[model samples]
Target: MKGLLYLSLIILIATILPLVGCNGSSEEVFKGYQLPPEREEGTTVELVIHETYTDEEHQVFQTIVDMFNEDNPDITVKVERIPKGAQWSRLTQALATKETPDIARVEMEYIATLADRGTILPMELFWAEDHKETLVEGAILSNTYNKRVWGIPDQIYTSALFYNVRLLEESGSDIPDSNWSWEDLMQLARKVSDRNPDVIGLSYGSSLWELSPYMGSYGATIYNSENKRIEIDSPEVVKALNLLYGYQLDVEGWTGSPIQSFINKDAAMVILDSNSIPKIEDSGIRFGVTKLPHGPAGSVSNIDGTSMVIFKDTEHPREAYEFLKFLTSSKIQALWADELGQLPVNKDSFKNVDVNKHPYLEIFMEQVSNVIPKPALPNYSQMEELFNMEMQKVFKGEKRLEHVLMDITSELNGETQKD
Candidate 1:
């Protein structure tokens, strides 16, 4: 009887030990890694990014990715590059096929479209509780649609007048100022233009979006917000187009490119987005940046930027959100903006010593505060296409300003009706 009791106790101890070990192992697996706060474990996320950036920019992005991976080993992020111009169409097709990346770098103009299509997940809860003050007001609104915040805005671009300071001084022309009017701008262009049979006074890339600020200065709206009708035929829009066409005709050396123009410095003054600043700085030209010249009504400028968004199909929404939050943090943004010459979306990032020391950085930041976000409409893609086509006709001098305006209004109205 004593031997049987001893044997039974031994068997009970063995069974209990194995069960305890199993419980510990299961807990370890569940507690693998801690992502931000709300993420789950054992999920891998994929990110899609633009292939347009320079090698240096890519290196910066990779460094950020490495930091994220170090902190969250259980959640892996794989990045894929897509061509810049093809990014939107490719993302659209992927979402349709249920292959969307967990996170995507999207254009600010497309935020509304993505939300409308249910491709993006709103991030208001994440941003409002942690990063509300970190971002600039204009940038935050750029990613907001119908009161829903669908993305985190990371970088920004604002239109500025880029002038060859040396050329302007050589031609005995005065530099433009914030108070300069449309007529003042025209005179300055005429003065700086190389009318010697080979030079033009001013050159613009010839897009309606690029020219919209000029139209806005005259109090023109592309769409009647209250009436919900296309208003490209407004008299103000016609006047803006005529002024743009005038530069091509009256300025002796003004020209357009079927291919590339601004990089080659084909014109004296170029109104370009802020992204082109670094390229122009590297060109070894002594350039100066000024506020975009004002028009008859008031001073106006357009905003351009990229937003960081998480797709609705992401397998690791929590992990992806953490990574995005890191990317948009003020500290990281300051480092990236100062080193890369890309404007930071965070207001405090502008206060960094290095960024403030850059000659053009302060001006760009000031402009960021005043610039207007593009129309956040689901039909913007269609509107952009029609606007570009009509503007091309005006640029080629094949259609009068009034005629192009009327045609664009008619076509846009038809599109809106269909929607």
Candidate 2:
């Protein structure tokens, strides 16, 4: 498989895409077509961006693109929005066929895979040294692969412990504080459930990288850097998994999609990111956000968000890069956060945005350091699939904790990748 991946990108482009009627349209006709250069006033770059965001979210981004066009008359950025889950698959196919957009907004987890395949342009191609200090370190580290940054973070991403304060109060439980523990959280969960049996006690996330938040609390890591091993079979991990399993067995809690379940009030408390705050707000439930409860190891969480990367075959690399840089500016970042309920990659912007204006965001900003970048593992894609499959078995009470851990660890240890 590794050997097959080494064909020169140029060869792939020449043989795969016929350059005749390849006018960027008709993916079926010009199946691998890209827009030709515009020798006009400004460089016109096509950007493909997708998210689970509402049309309102896309409108905010269009506003940003318009702002960029107004200031830099020499650059034109055309934006296209696609749905999230299918975005990465489509982008990969496009790259393989040499028909790719000039710019793509990618999830940070996919950046390494795309970069390793030489599909995305390197950040050093555009990012200035002075700009380095202006952004958060995690954003840089998240985009780095093979010692070169492959993308620039458009949004600083992190999650908080979101709870329905009114529900907790009604259940006669005190609201959680910054220093709360996992035990405290569980107790609160049980209380809310007992008080309102119709509503669930918790909504645990079963999404990609969802398990990371609980692992560290018990002094466990899915992948332990110190020993250079995947620790799925470790006692700490089993304890963590069982804790969640216990919740499901006890109260009929846990959902495949925590964010939606939370919005529906199917669960009283759940782990959520600031990006989902708008929906929670619109749900008309009195709620608040806090740092996740700590375990013996301390409070730790995962940062899962998207970044913007330029495709290597872009005709307008400079223009696309300029637009990416423009998005990083403090004022523009603040606007992005204001429109989209996310944290700013620029640290200074955090101070400028009044929390009163964007509630629950401050908790996200405060916990940024506690939240680590998804492991820079090249094979994380494969591991995520395996983890989810194994977890489902445990959730259904079909497998014992020790037996499942052993299987997961054995599978992960046998998988190998080249650096």
Candidate 3:
């Protein structure tokens, strides 16, 4: 859904691109439309900080804002907190008016889309001015293309297998280990599903993002990083699809709306990220997390996070850069990770908290090391949609796996030329 929002904005902007400016000079419209000009320099610069965070979650970030303002009296930072679900529409609406916040907490996947639009300012602009060490591990490379960095990773998370301990025990299934194999997971699922007809073995979202852990585990790669080409028609990917297909048709696996079903005891296990701990903790469901079972390739999980980026059009580049640097500083990043139970990107932040001390976190911390990231490409949003459609066809038995994969690879590779 979020990927569609990015595609929609890009399409909308391209359709109504400006032909010229008010000064009678022909305006140069790049792929993203146009690069915004900087605002006039002033002693006191006012900046707007936009990001999607709940009122409760806002406190964590707001505390940082307070610290920034106190440290730098000359710069004023305003906070704009939007609900995560509404971010796409809100951001699209603002971009329609050619307006964006001075700085925003954007998802790593969105960097390439925004950067291509020329709305995002390069991170290099602040490299010389600020000495902040950016946190990049577990961060998607969509923000870094052609040797230019777009944003600083603020928080990182990887997908893990979360099992309901009580549900597994009730179904007479033993809890799986951290090094369990795919065969082991399947066997456990069969045992649990046989006991509970209404309950499924596992629940996960049916999309490229959710399917990534399984795909990577089986060595199914969507992109060839070396050649920058889409290559989805490999034997490994086909096998992975057949496995998921079996789970859906033969095993009657559950997909999507996982959190509620997991809490309701309708599913024995669910694949989710660390951010889910707060939800499961309050549901009174005794749960334990472990790394995804190893497939032919190896155990793998998908990594995602929010990145802090500045707008190229900001009037106060220097002041905004100062705040950007402050927001991404090791001191602030470490504190943020500890307060939120999120994975830190900065190397220094790692030592501040013993991730193993927290429940379920130690499992996630280990899984984070063996993870895969979403691809960073200008046409990524569209490519994601293509996978969703093609994968569904295979799952529903409407298309042969081999044929679908071939079409996807050709279609995606062809899309690159169009761009």
lDDT of 3: 0.71
Q: What local lDDT score does residue 227 receive in model 1, on the 0 to 100 scale? A: 60
What's the TM-score of each model vs. the native? 0.77, 0.77, 0.79
Instruction: Write one digit per residue (lDDT tens) for candidate 3, span 189-238.
Output: 87888898877887766678888888889987766666656667778877
Ten contiguous residues with the weakest lDDT in model 1: 17-26
Q: Candidate 2, residues 165-270: lDDT per residue as tens digits?
A: 7677778888887789887888888888888898777778655467777876687766554454667778987787778777778886767888887788777788
Number of clashes found in candidate 3: 2
lDDT of 2: 0.71
**Local distance difference test, each candidate:** 0.66, 0.71, 0.71
Instruction: Provide C-alpha RMSD values for all models, in order.
Output: 19.3, 9.1, 6.7
Q: In TM-score terms, which candidate is top?
A: 3
**Which parts of model 3 are misplaced by more than 4 Å?**
1-44, 83-99, 128-134, 195-198, 354-358, 415-419
